[model samples]
Target: MAVAAIAGGTFAFKALDKSVKLVVDGKTQSVSTYASNVEGVLKDANVKVVKRDDLTPKLTAAVADGGTIVLNRARPLAIDIDGVHSKKWVTAYTVEEALSQLGIDGGADVSASRSQRLPLKGASLEVTTPKTVAINVDGQAISVVSTGATVKDVLDAQSISLVEGDFTTPAVDTPVTSGMQVDVTRVRTTTTQEAQPVPYSTSEQPDGTMNKGDKKVVTKGVAGEQVVTYTVTTTNGVVSAKTQVSAQVTVAPVNEVVNVGTKEAPVAAAPAPSGSGAGSSGGGSNAGAIPSSGGLNWPALAQCESSGNPKAVSPAGYMGLYQFDQRTWNANGGSGSPLDASAAQQTAIAQNLYNARGISPWPSCGPKLLS
Candidate 1:
């Protein structure tokens, strides 16, 4: 009865022991045992906790009633760093610790998984470590160590400054290559003033009292002065770019004004009847009424040509006292038809013709005018 009682007492002690919850790699289970510590609980559950495995409520901590314990079993982590592949067990669940364990500084670029926690089974890491590169900027060669992706990224890593209107050869966004030559041309702007000439303009005004088709200049035109501002850009100590910024007139130009006539001409007096009336009433009265000008006898000439009838028209289309054609009359200042002119006006035009060319215009009657 004593031995049976002791066995029953041991069973009661085990039954009254603490109960602990275990979560392993996201799987949950309840465990009840007479365990005093985390190691005891793990041993009772028959779980192997290696040095690289993550265990919570550490192996030395005491087990409590209704307490939960978590364990994430880590796996082999394979990483390629500096062109070398290495394999190891990492207890840390995050990739950052994995990189640190591989003796890699934070100056390298890891695949996005670097920031994420380790997978349940295992993980692979790819790292692009910084390397030396040579670049040319503004004809100057430079050396730098970088893990950037493009030419622009390399420049940004070196703390380079770029402003508006600046450019580079081979383009900045192009992918970076080993020993690539990049030429950066620095651009600077400068303003300058230039003297330029402004051309003058001419305008005309109408004049009614003067002869039609006649023009006269009233004012002369003069050219003005202007100043032009230009923005000049120089690249690599060379002047090759220019742009006009503004233009200001320094002197106003004067426009020339001309007067154009639009008035109608007066009508000519009609010629007298052709006969002894060739000299007009001033020459019509007597046979001796010969009016002489420039030492020429006009009456004798007119008597021979028209016989005193000044308004007569010859079969040859000639008219007036001097037997003048329409062409000759107009050329001598008579308007319209010669017969449309007064005898006095015809005689005056004849006198002008005689004065300018002597009695030669009379032809067969010229000798008589000189007589």
Candidate 2:
């Protein structure tokens, strides 16, 4: 009876024993455990399971004979996709397996080889996917299928260089995306100088030495010269904008000086001979002596009215250096069209008209007579 009890105990022990195949992180090994559940079997084999680890069977499940158990140890991994960085817990042993489990396919560019082993502690990986983008530059449309990480990478691959004033629509540092359009605008800037005329100002001073209606020029006016600098921008070989950046006066204007008469006449010089004098109706007034110097600026008025051309004729039937109409010319002792007379003759008539009108005839050009 004692021998039979020992045999029965041995049978019970054999019945409880289980033969299981244990795979830890892709390494296979056979384990023999007398424990009843999966947890007990793993404990007997000295295999640890963490929350982040992948376990094929539940810990509380009953252990079966000749069963397979898979336990993939989770590892820390740093991943960068198109410049965006992230950390992931992956249960794969190799880079290829990790990518597959992360839903990454073969068309992506990776920093490490697909078959490289993923270390248990940690490993870093950079990924770039193929994208379709249109590049418009230099008046041409270029289509690209690239695996670059950013817009700058794409441009560099195409041998495109950016100058100081050059720019892109989507900045060069921007991440690349599918179906994104990139426009490169070629800019060229230049500074140009141009000469500009500055109108001269007039100033007047009273002089008591001259007669009431007499005037004398003391200084001649000169227009000033200025150099204007412009910032000209050209885009794609076309002028886009021209902005005035600076202006410098190279030559200053010399103001004109004139003396006006403020003295009273000496009793009209005892009413001298009135024969063929100024303002006379004689047909020979062209040879008559008329005072050239006057209260107004006659030369300036002629320059403003007819550009100093004595024979100048206006479309309004006005003629001569003073732009006189026919009726006014006849009233001012002018014969026929003022253009038919000599410059001296025209001047005499103009002086006679000025003595009568007091600079009211040339309304537009009268202001130019100021000192």
Candidate number achieving the greatest TM-score relative to the actual structure: 2
Error of 1 at 330 (Å): 26
What are the RMSD figures for all models against the true structure? Answer: 16.6, 11.2
TM-score for each model = 0.35, 0.50
Top lDDT hit: 2
Off by over 4 Å in 2: 1-16, 104-106, 159-167, 187-235, 239-371
Per-candidate Cα lDDT values, in order, are 0.72, 0.77
Cα-based RMSD of candidate 1: 16.6
Q: How many backbone clashes does candidate 1 have?
A: 20
Judged by lDDT against the true structure, how good is candidate 2?
Answer: 0.77
Candidate 1: stretches off by over 4 Å: 1-136, 139-153, 156-160, 167-190, 208-210, 230-245, 263-371
The 10 consecutive residues of candidate 2 with the worst lDDT sum are: 267-276
lDDT of 1 by residue, 95-180 (tens): 88777866777888887566688875788887767767676666678998887666787889987766776777768887666566
